[model samples]
Target: MPKIYTEKHLLLFLYNELAAEEVVEMNAELAKNPVLFEQYQHLKSGIAALDSLSEEPSQTSIDLVMEYAQKLAAAEVANV
Candidate 1:
């Protein structure tokens, strides 16, 4: 019997979480199955968009974290 590939499997395949054999199987299915290929393409686009997001925090966030760390270190030094 042929395997029924779901969106879940496509996501796993996209993330390369599938086993080597499974990857091979999914590649074949994606080529052969239009609906599955479309779903995979949508997922790929979403992942690409997410990947394009700003990876670093804002400067204000960095400053706040640094301020807190400095205060904690000062308190520790005072305690010692």
Candidate 2:
């Protein structure tokens, strides 16, 4: 398989979106290509940082979302 040359392709590998055969091909390329190794490191760091992000929604946003959801539910019931 050809070396992955796009962020989308790299993301597929980084996120385990690749099929098993494709992943094996990618690992082979990664072993031979220093540039691909560096790119992988960069992407791995980015994904790790993203994974560590906090999940708690802000109170204001949560309230607004809940309000909108209630309005949608009310509208749906009224249309029934």
Candidate 3:
């Protein structure tokens, strides 16, 4: 019987989370199934785009965290 692959399986394969044997099986599936191959390509592109994103915190968030830390330190000093 042929193994059925889903989008989740494809994602795992794309992210290198699959076992070596599973990778081989998925590769074979991609080679024979044009639709699967296309889906893989689209997913690959989307992952690449997401990987390129920057996750820097905004200045306001940084300031708030710093203020919270200062309050914690002040409380600790008062308790000492």
Candidate 4:
């Protein structure tokens, strides 16, 4: 029986989480199914767009995280 690939499988393949065997199988399927190939292309482009728009946390956000970590460490020391 042939495997029926879903969007989740495609996402796993896109994110490099697919096993080597699965990668080969999915690639073959993509080649044979134009609709699957189109979906993959759309998802790939969406991921690229998201990557381009990604930004680092602001200084204030970094400082807040650091302060929280320090407070947590101090509380742990007190308990010890």
Candidate 5:
């Protein structure tokens, strides 16, 4: 199988969720690519720290949040 260290690869690595054979190949690639290795480390840390975020906000929640943000920005501009 062809090995690639793309964003998808990094996300999978962060979760410690690779297949056995893929893990072996990914380790080999990490040995060769220092930059990708660093990226994996960074993403791993982020994944470790990022807990569940609000039980997956609904579309209405997202729309409301965006609207509120825009209103806040507009108010700030009006004040300025």
Candidate 6:
């Protein structure tokens, strides 16, 4: 029986979450299926856009987290 591909499967394939054999199958299907290929291209572009974003949290967000952690540690120390 032929394998049925879905958008979810294409996303999995993009992330390399598919098994080796499934990767091979998906590659073959993408070649023959224009709709699936288009979907994959769209997903790939989205991924690329995400990858181009800043990898680290903003300084303000990091400061808030550090401040909260310090407060927690201080409380723990006071209790001990």
Best candidate, lDDT-wise? Answer: 3
- Taking all chains together, each candidate's TM-score versus the true structure is 0.72, 0.81, 0.79, 0.75, 0.54, 0.82
Question: Which 10 residues in a row give candidate 5 its minimum summed lDDT?
Answer: 46-55
The candidate, 1 or 5, that scores higher on TM-score is: 1
Worst 10 residues of 6 by lDDT: 1-10
Tens-digit per-residue lDDT, 27-80, candidate 5: 889889999888888887777667644477899999999999999999999999
State the lDDT at 37 in candidate 6. Answer: 96
**Model 1: clashing residue pairs?**
none
In model 5, pairs of residues that clash are none
* Local distance difference test values of all predictions, in order: 0.90, 0.87, 0.92, 0.91, 0.81, 0.90
Residue lDDT tens for model 1, 1-80: 14988888988888989988888988888889999999999999999999999889999999999999999999999999
Q: How well is each residue in 1-80 modelled by candidate 3, as lDDT tens digits? A: 14887889899999899999899999999999999899999999999999999999999999999999999999999999
lDDT of 6 by residue, 18-57 (tens): 8998889999999999998999999999999999998888
Give the total clashing residue pairs for model 5: 0
Following a full C-alpha superposition, what root-mean-square deviation does model 6 have from the true structure? 2.2
Query: Top TM-score: which candidate number?
Result: 6
C-alpha displacement of 37 in model 5, angstroms?
Answer: 0.7
Per-residue lDDT over 30-66 for candidate 4, one digit per residue giving the tens place of the 0 to 100 score: 9999999999999999999998996899999999999
Candidate 4, poorest ten consecutive residues by summed lDDT: 1-10
Order the candidates by TM-score, highest first — what do you get?
A: 6, 2, 3, 4, 1, 5
How many clashing residue pairs appear in each of the predictions shown?
0, 0, 0, 0, 0, 0
Error of 3 at 60 (Å): 0.4
| Residue 44 miss distance in model 2 (angstroms) | 0.4
Please state every model's RMSD to the true fold in angstroms: 2.9, 1.8, 2.6, 2.2, 10.1, 2.2
